[model samples]
Target: MTDTRKSTQNAVGAPGRAADGLAARLVVERGAFRLDVTLTAAPGDVVALLGPNGAGKTTALRALAGLVPLAGGHLRLDGAELDRTPPESRPVGVVFQDYLLFPHLSALDNVAFGPRCHGASRAEARAQAAAWLERMGLAEHAAAKPRRLSGGQAQRVALARALATHPRLLLLDEPLAALDARTRLDVRAQLRRHLADFEAVAVLVTHDPLDAMVLADHLVVIEDGRVVQEGTPADIARHPRTDYIAHLVGLNLYRGQARGHAVQVDGGCVVTTTEDLTGPAFVAFAPGAVTLHRERPAGSSARNLWRCEVAGLQSHGDQIRADLTGELPLAADLTTVAAAELDLRPGATVWATVKAAQTHAYPA
Candidate 1:
């Protein structure tokens, strides 16, 4: 079988002379789980594979590293094909989750191992190793063994070793997963700088949304072995196509942005609000917070009101997810019959309101 794939990215940056990239249409088959994915990363571009646990993110990374064989499809780096190449023969570097340093070797020797395997002279490899160690801020610990190093130090050493060989592609599997929360923050910043300087393709598999958003310019979100959503963080945040992504994209998720005593929409449209907040802020009310009525409330405490057109409706468990497009775009969840009673259909404009007490403001 043949599959057509596209880079799905604008080729704005010309590949530099230092490194090209690694691309793959990977398929792996097993008893109950199968992964089929396609990805292309630029020379300095970091592509993050994000998903929940057991979502085939790691499976895909392993397939690219040749730890597991591809059931079908092709793998390429720069302009060369690498489908049949052995893991060691492939011009790829891997930083596993465990930061698997040699127990008996010093930090410097571990970093030197890759260069040595690549046929550098022992002295040359040691010299290169020293340089890498210093680059990772571990020059003083060159003689320290893995057992003596802290978790963050060990992680940096693993990264230094991966880069020492000067591989064409780098594969990092949950690089920050092993670190403590405090260490993670510092290492994450350091890793970002290193990746920025890396002139090769880098693919990182992570379940953490923060990691994916911080480290990758392009995001490929996989679920059940399929590419569910792929886009920039801003695009995904504004228009969440899936519930999982909705949570990942932080939104106060309010019905209105609170003003002094009113909220404005498009074309001079305004809704009087009871909330009293100054400066730039937001007002939040949930889908479940809204209660629909057959007609506008004659006299009520509800201050915010809108004539909304039902853009779309989706079923989420027992509740209904409603998309409304009118003066302001909004997503509201209501019960099944409430939607039916209001006859919420596309293009049907209905009066929607929320109490001023319900509105809230937070720092943007």
Candidate 2:
């Protein structure tokens, strides 16, 4: 397994310079589950915690917010240790998944609440809140209550509220989850702009790959409470280290022993690849790379071919995704017309082929 801590630490700079940014090894134990992951980010960096449900993304966020107590390890921001700090006292801002705007308060008051709690006078808090609302383009909705505002407006109010206190660290838990698909697209673009203007470290938790890829400067992929991969969005998408990541990035991934350009994958299926690799290796190819036929193709030049059974089928946008089993269990994508021509359905046998040029192999 990769030493994600070392890699991340190196990416941000040396540990001795942790004072310049956010540095922490979060360790939290709950019943049988434990999360031990190292996270580091310089000022102005946006790090997204990308993981599946129950993968400890939320737990790590809570730990940073001082809501969840740490079993071991420390939390530090801008050189200050915050492990024992109370949630209310930490210089951190959190935007919950649900927005959590005070239903009774107007948007102005909701935004001013954070500054008030941080010891600003009513007038000063309101002044700061007003500026943040203006920055968020929600100044016209100052008097609107949470109940009267649209989902997008309410989310902006929540974000404005979090930013009023001038926090050194911002934590957003699925900031765009409440919006509709159309609203999400607009709000996501807006949020990306806002995050770019932020001068402090920001950490966001999300399961949406598109959101993470678009909004985060770096991605930390957590699985079963551990860091499985951490890198730029493009890097992780190009070279997924785990099955979850492979699926998340829309690729069919397999592990096996490599001999030159051939990989002996699971089920004794040998895959021919374009890269020359040896020893333990991983082979990955996009589902679209696979071509399916009712019978084996004769005089085909493709070096990688398998006899597979269609275990299931589902719509994926304009294309159909077929889950296959047998010689090599994998997912394949084909056009609706092609699928119809093949008479693809569960339990149907088919021959799948992929050119060696489509397969990528790398040392595991």
Candidate 3:
């Protein structure tokens, strides 16, 4: 393990350096799969790990909390090396997806459990737990058991318990995955406020893009156990580098060769963009930018047009999303009234047009 760590450090060019907040290059191996991700964040920063299932998001969280052993690399928090520390001795708190509160214990006792485990007296632990519950707005349910509490109330109690431990690093795994839509809204806002007030580093693992955008200051998108992209929410939404990210941000993306203002994309289709570029490039546009016509209109001002066949249709809020395939495969959004007027259906033929100004092209 020591040799592996040395090699990893040499490869990445950073080792044995102490820094404030959380800095880690997590490397874990399981059978045929390996996860190697480097993450750094300052105090009061909320970082989210987002990816599809089996992408090692949960594994990264577990490694940070000392629940999984690191095969290589280093783990440091506030200038302290914790690669060999046991889970119980690490200054970390974890909130699982299921809110694993003791079923037989009252809310107050559940919150006090951590303090008591850390050698606090009964009175001191209860006092601290009471203060935390009050802060979470669950003081009225102090005596209620986990089974008797609402989903949102139980989640608060779990958070209070984790916070009571005075951990420097907090880990949340799918924190809002268990809540209903309405309850999730309320709890998400509350969690964001609490995270902002927290003075330590927090790492959240979730698959929901909306949750990541709403709660995290930084997003690390992992795919196949590697860090594919990392950036602020707005920056990522505007410039997506991968197909998964483009889908997550609701954009049609393609890669091709660029010559001046025109890009020759896949299937021999050319896209005209306002930005002039050369060499390898990427073109992206939103579904709303596409206009569908039953017949190819001559003398149209649009610079980009495609002959397509409707592959499918789905409802998107007040609009209808038409999936097209032929010369170019893409999605188009139109009002229900417009869709009816065009008589759009599966296997129907249509001509799609997108203005050059609406297409964004950049270096790949």
Evaluation by lDDT, superior candidate among 1 and 2: 2
Colliding pairs, model 1: 254-284, 287-333
Q: What 10-residue stretch in candidate 3 is worst by lDDT? A: 5-14
Model 1: per-residue Cα lDDT over 1-364, one tens digit each: 0011122221222133633477789998988888999898767678889887888999998888889999998899987888888999988899999999999999999999998999999998899889888888899999999999999999999998988877778899999999999999999998887777677788999978888878877888888887888887656555444446655663324333446776553345554545565544434455654555546777756776666777888896798877776755567778888888778777777667766666544422
lDDT of 2 by residue, 89-187 (tens): 998999999998888899999999988987889998888788888888888999988998998889889988887776778999999988999999999
Q: What's the TM-score of every candidate structure?
A: 0.68, 0.94, 0.93
Q: Can you tell me which runs of candidate 1 are displaced by over 4 Å?
A: 1-20, 251-364
> Which consecutive 10 residues in model 1 have the weakest lDDT in total?
1-10
Q: Would you list the C-alpha lDDT of every candidate in the order shown?
A: 0.76, 0.89, 0.90
* Best candidate (score: TM-score): 2
Model 1 has an lDDT value of 0.76
Model 3, 120-163: lDDT tens digits are 99999999899889989998999999989988898899988998
How many clashes in each structure? Answer: 2, 0, 0
